[model samples]
Target chain A: MELVVVSVLGADRVGIVAGIASVLARHNANIVDISQTVVRDIFSMIMVVDISKADVDISQLRRELEEEGKRLGVMVGVFHIDVFKYMQRI
Target chain B: MRFDPREIGEVLEMLVFRELDIRAVTLSVNTLPAIRPNLKDALDALSHLLEPYARRLRPAAEKVASKLGVRIVTVRLAVSPTSIMLEPLGDAKAAVEIAAFLDELAGRHGVDMVGGFSAFVHGGVSRGAAALIEGLAEALNSTERVAGFLNAASTMTGINLEAVRRAARIVLSLKPHAAARFAVTANLPEDVPFMPGAYHGLGQPDAVVNIAVSGPGVIEAVVRSLPDADVRTLHDAIKRAAFKITRLGELVGREVAKELGVAFGAVDLSVAPSPKVGDSVAAVLEAMGLPRVGAPGSVFALALFTDAVKKGGAMAASTIGGLSGAFIPVSEDAVMSQAAAEGAITLDGLKAMAAVCNTGLDMVGIPADVGPDVVAAIIADVMALAVHLDKPLGVRLIPVPGARPGDIYDLGGLYGRVAVVDASRYSKIPLVARPGTAPPGVERLKKG
Candidate 1:
């Protein structure tokens, strides 16, 4: 299955996770794993999802997350897992 | 194995916060095939051979850098030295033409600078070497992208005092802004960085991909976080930090080399700093509790820092080569420049630092009216250390014509702003002290 990492970072706010999940559900993406933390009062989250059965492609999902993130006052990004894998291989 | 979120977070922190990067990705393209008797034929051969390679390098470099989230400071191309070409070409004009052509090719290919406008003249001055040295002034003045040097001293060859004098005279006479693009080295390496000294040495492949990794800011961050740590703890922290930093270079460098279809060369293990704030190597010293660089124990700090980095980088890179030590460029590193401005770092102190670091007297400025003999004296001092100790050393002296000590010369971008240093009371060596036999390194090279 094709996997992607989606991240959101900003100050603490309400409904950020639900709002992100709402978009993923509409696109038929399976949220395989999720992790969140608050460091120095900044909210950072990372979600790994299976994109094999998604209705929309990664680019479109990234655009949607970016638009939604702007409205929610958060910074959002999407990336392939290969980059992280290369670093963690040792 | 399943990946962890913390691993991703750690990389993101280094990329976003620490500003880790690959400083330079140099592509060495062979121009030995282009050396010829006729000037036009040589130029034609070079353009034909180099055009396609140059065209593809920048695009591939940019694509790889962006996709991997690694910022590449510059993409450079090093050619084989042009000194060998000057012999059959008949005149220095061909040398000038070749330099200009290299400049044009670099401009067209979006290569930042084209190195190896160089002469390996340590066997005293040959006819071809003399022609290159004679043409150096005009060629550097005429071409923006061309960088040149003369390796006139070595551990085996001792020192080429005559050629050294010529290089010194060339600098004092021309005062070419591009003099910063040239250097004189002793015991120079086949592969190295912090140019004007980096050249694709003889017998290396036509095209090789090498990387110079930089992360002075990251080193500073580690030292800062360990405020009260003892020397042992501090050393461990820097090693851990440099291991990660050089790992990024190795991974990305290997990928870049694979994509470009060239041999993967070394990752220069240096924490080269830029003019950007918070990116200075001197800042690392300050973070280690020194009020300023050149203070007491400063050189010791630099030595330990460099040694630890080398140890860590050696562990990480597939093959660690190209100046596996620290870079102490004054103008390029903001903290270094500041120290110079405040008179905390002296020229002599920097000369001492160069002995321990990878390069020598780099980006140092001097008064415009300094005599050639004085320049020769300064180079002589550094070259002596390089030859005696057997290390790669390059002297990039900027002599500001008619300027005096404490005057600042603003060389924008990577070269940065440099304050003219006091080189007034220099030794007067009126004659080239020629010896009966060649230096030690040359004898070994011959026997080998």
Candidate 2:
């Protein structure tokens, strides 16, 4: 499976998740898992999305998500899931 | 979440906020095969051999970096030490010509820098080594993208004071910011992905990709997160951070090497720092509760930091190479430069720190008027330490033009700002003028 870990971090707001989810949905990327938290009073969202079926490539999806994230006043990063596995896993 | 939210969040925080990134992805290309008896043929062969690899480097690095979302700064190329390549030609002018060609090649192909204009003269200077050393000033001065290293001292070969003197003289002749691109090294590693020390060893395969990881900011954040933690706990925290950083380096190196159709070499676990405000090894020490970087407990803090990183990196990567200790480049790290500017750190203090650190006397700016003898003496001091310690160390001194002690030279952009530190107290030393290789350290005499 071509999985990606998309993370968003910024000030707390209403449309941050909606803005990101819509972009992923429009690209046909399926969100498999999501977890949001307010750590140190800063809002952060982590989403594992299956990008294999996406209409756009990872770069295009990243750009759209980032643009939407900027509109929602957050910083968004899209990385292949292996980045996490390689770093965090034994 | 597929993984723990905290784990994902931590990785993001390190990447996004903590200034963590792969410092360099250096492709080590063996250029010995390109050497020909004729200078023109040699240049042609070298050009043909390296151009394709150089051309692919940036794109491959970018492809891996974009896919992994880990920024790989500075895609560099390291070749076999130019002295060896130019030896057969027996022409001093050939060094400058080759340097210019390599500089152009690097620039045209989007390679950030090209290393390995180097000579291994730890024992004695050969005709080829002498030629390379002779043309070093001109070659480095004229070339923007080429970096050079002179291994004047090593554990097995001892300290070559004559070679050190020659290197210092070359440093004196270099133009502004040119000194930043060259180094006089002791026990220079063949596969360190950092310049101006990287070189393809004779032992290495035709090509390999080595990664240098920079994460002083990430480690500092880890240290800062444990404000009241015990000493061992603090060490463990640092280890965990270093593990992740090395893993990132390994991943990037493997992917880039695969993309370029080369072998993955090793990850240099050096916690290299940039000139950015938060990205500093000194800051990491400060975060470990030092009132300032050069405060009393600084050495102990650095030792602890480096040891933990080595341990973490050892566990994380299959093969760890290069200068795996934390780098304390004065100008390139904002805090260290500030410490130097504030008189919190002196040349002697930095030398003391280098006793335990990876690189020695790096990117330090001294008074412009300081004689070659003084610089030679300093290089000799560093060489002596490296010989005794049997470790890798390098000295990159910038003799800022017309600058005095306490004056700040703003070289700007990655080379960063340098505060001129005093080296005049040792200026009268005539020991370096005594031309001979010093005997190896006591470690060499040890028997199993």
For all candidates listed, what's the TM-score of chain B alone?
0.95, 0.98
Model 1 TM-score relative to the real fold: 0.91
Cα deviation at A24, candidate 1, in Å, is 7.3
Q: Assess every candidate by TM-score.
A: 0.91, 0.97
**Tens digit of per-residue lDDT, candidate 1, span B136-190:** 8899988888898998887767778777877788777655368779888886666
DockQ in order? 0.37, 0.83
What is the lDDT of every predicted structure here? 0.81, 0.89
Model 2: per-residue Cα lDDT over B213-319, one tens digit each: 98899998888889999999999999999999999988888899899999999999988999998899999999999988888888899999999999999888879
Question: Which regions of candidate 2 deviate over 4 angstroms?
Answer: A12-14, A38-43
Question: Which stretch of 10 consecutive residues in model 2 chain A shows the poorest summed lDDT?
Answer: A36-45
Task: For model 1, give the TM-score of chain B.
Answer: 0.95
